[model samples]
Target: MSTSITIFDTTLRDGTQGEGISLSADDKLKIAKKLDDLGVHFIEGGIPGSNNKDIEFFRRVQSLGLRAKISAFGSTRRKHSLAEQDENLQRMLAAGVPAATLVGKAWDFHVHTALQTTLEENLAMIGDSIAYLKRKGLEVVFDAEHFFDGYKHNPEYAAAVLSRAREAGADWLVMCDTNGGTLPGEVHEIVSAVGLALPGAPLGVHTHNDCELAVANTLAAVQAGARHIQGTVNGYGERCGNANLCSLLPTLQLKMNYTCIPHESMAQLTNTARYVSEIANVNMPVNQPYVGSAAFAHKGGIHVSAILRDSRTYEHIEPEKVGNKQRVLVSELAGQSNVLSKAQQIGLHLDPSSEQARKIIDRIKELEHQGYQFEGADASLELLLREATGEIDELFTFESFKMLVEKTAGGSVVSEAFVKLNVAGESLYTAAEGNGPVNALDNALRKALIPYFPSLRDMHLSDYKVRVLDEQDQTAAKVRVLIESRDYRTAWSTVGVSGNVIEASWEALVDSMRYALLGLHSPQPVRTEFGQRGLVNH
Candidate 1:
């Protein structure tokens, strides 16, 4: 068995089988570049003649200049057809890619029943398809579709199909757990047999997550001598999804000592997973192994205190090894270390024993007990910590504001808001209209601040979320608004809670602006009864 493995990512092909996962040709090319930069060996671009979008992807990827070979996926010729004259094979050659992966029926159930073909004819089809592709001088990878189930029922026929592809000059005999029912022990056992059956031929495994063991099964195959690993980013695929490369690659390189992705590029694993999730419009699984936001997050007070002295106290490995950070999740359940660690991350050197730090932690606990969660609102936490020390400058103050709504002749309602701010004790007022009440308030607030703080022009709200604190009160319940804002460089989150929805939104928006202004000035850290947090431009 080879020591180094090939990383084959099928995000553009099998990954699109997932519901709600779709990508344009341009999106496909961009992701392919990211995968190449991460040092993956092969990328399955998609079947050329399957869809117009896939056809366009082939055309666009031709100029990508990637290190990874872009393989086009298709199937063997129909039963009883000449391989040279096969339409599918003809398109595969026309794709002009370096590699071709063709999946054929290795299961007798699919052959004798689905295609209604005899066992002998199916073997002939597999051999002819591979031989024809080899004659065209293309690198061929034979995917033994349903190989595991086939071996369980008709072991002889399953072994025969793989041998036929090998004899016909297929470069790789890829065993696929199409139904994903096979366990890891079974995968290891079968891949070992397949390796012996086709001596001198390279082996590979493709798996699904129907049993929630795609990653385990893929690793098991690698343990049993498979060299090329097939998977998708964040495990995005049909049904439960394919083997997750985010989890698999790290396991192979860091644990098993198998060489896959380059050691230096491993740090990019988190960003790569997040990039694909964003383009696919999928939420990042917070607890996903290695790359998730909460993978290395410490929340318990006991765990936080120990991790402050030694990160290995609760962590298995340094999170930075995978482009992730050790996060001290501050909540009502936190202790002094949570406060000190969070402050340290934002460039604050706080004296944990001091009154200001204790006051900040106490207030955070009180607010969270009242249903204000701060895990996603660390910028708000920073503002509170600085404010408690009297170190934060008051950039703006509320004087008075009014909101108005007007109904047009077309049955559309328009909202207008006017905001009054006391800037340097001078009254400044502005009015603006928007698609909704929150938007109008945001516009009016920015207008009022631009004259005094023009840097607010470069900042804008990126995301807004609302949660009801007391659902029993229904419309009268206090609503918590969390707003994420970004300037030209980085982003931050702030939160607020109030019984009135508009008022809650206004509070969060104001804090977001204040944090941005504070970050811009980067005021010096000062010492008092407690140490202060430095504003290092966030």
Candidate 2:
């Protein structure tokens, strides 16, 4: 049997059935072009006759020049209607795709109750729909909706539907777990029987992740003679989800020796998953298989050390193969290996046994002991390395600052703050008011330095987080604040710890601005004979 399988991406069709998923025609067209670039064999556009957005997508997508075959989806014709006159079939043809997939009731329960039609009538609907599309020069795919559950309830009727579609010229007969409750073993056994029942009929599988077994069931169906696998990127779909192509594609190619995409396009799989998630406004799962941020992250000291020696000791495959980089995290749980690895990555050239290296390691331990974790503040750690080694300049030092708040008659609160900075042997003072005390403080600080550094306006704080480190002193507990700041080019995070929340936030904010300036002037470190450090322009 051929190991290569056709990849049918349904992110636009069944994927939009997800609860909060709404996409415009332009969004769907962009996604179709991306899927084509990713080398999927077929891309399923939404049901053409169902909505206005899908109609426009079918019209706009013709100009994209995508290499993949765009397929339109719809249900079989209405009961007792002529195939040529059916609105669904006519709309599918107007969409101008080479292939059209039609879903028909496979379960007797649905035919007798939901569809309110006889089994023989449902069979005729499937056969007539496929025959009509085939005569229009379109390759037809027959989706046996609820196939697994239907086959168990009425095996003969389900097999008869597949036979009718095959006789009527359907190119691929797809088995769908519409309710998403089928087990892997059950899917394999039923698909195996179906393969035997309809000999020479091309078979495919479509599943959902209600039981978290969509991927497992799809694999099982493939093992039992299914050739085409339908799924969505990052598993976006109704209910739990569809099978995740991010997980399924790599697993099939790397573990099972099956080919689902062009070899050169395999590396783009991770980026494709992330791109779709971004467009859908879905956050990427940190621990999702193969493509997540934490998929190959080494956090434990032991794991990091082993990975440093031989990546094969802790990694199942090379991270680069999937376009994800390995992350060596340094926190309270890290060891000397973590420091060495991080320093190298940050371009700090320190001998592992040197006094400077030992100082950096000891300082990190001491700070983390006081709840100043460096795990999320790599930029701050790099700043510390430069400061300790005298590779950086003393930009500025803090002076006394004060914040005042008042309540107006309308129950509105107003706040103001003043900041004084000792910049280049001169005192710079500024004051401002804002919606809150923190915002007031930020405004005052930025105003204080705008004269010395005009580029300070380009950088602003993006996120701020504060966590109380001690519950023992409820009223006076120490707080840790983390601030993320970004300029036009990149972003960085800094952390601070203190008993007062305002003080902690101020420290983190200052560090964030200082780091942002450092990127602007990346001066080389100059060492003196007295073991002092200074910066020299490179």
Which prediction has the highest TM-score against the true structure? 1
Q: What is candidate 1's lDDT per residue for 86-169, written digit by digit as tens?
A: 999999999999999999998999997888998889999889999999988999988999999999898899999988998999
| Candidate 1 whole-model C-alpha lDDT, 0 to 1 | 0.87
lDDT (CA) for every model shown?
A: 0.87, 0.85
Per-residue lDDT tens digits for candidate 2, residues 1-538, read 4389989999999888887888888888878888998899989999886889998988888888888888999989999999999988899999998889889999999999999989999999999999999999998778899999999988998888889989999899999998899999999999999988888679999999999999999999999999999999999999898999988888888888898988788888878887787677676787998998779888787888898889899899898888787877777677777777776777777787788878887888888989897767767887887887777776777888888899978798988888887766666566888778878888887766655577888988876889999999896999999887878776678999999988888888888878877754432223333222221111
**Residue-level lDDT for 74 in candidate 2:** 91
Task: Tell me model 2's lDDT, rounded to 2 decimals.
Answer: 0.85
RMSD of each: 6.0, 6.3
List pairs with backbone clashes in candidate 1: none
Backbone clash pairs in model 1 (N, Cα, C under 3 Å; residues 3+ apart or in different chains), count: 0
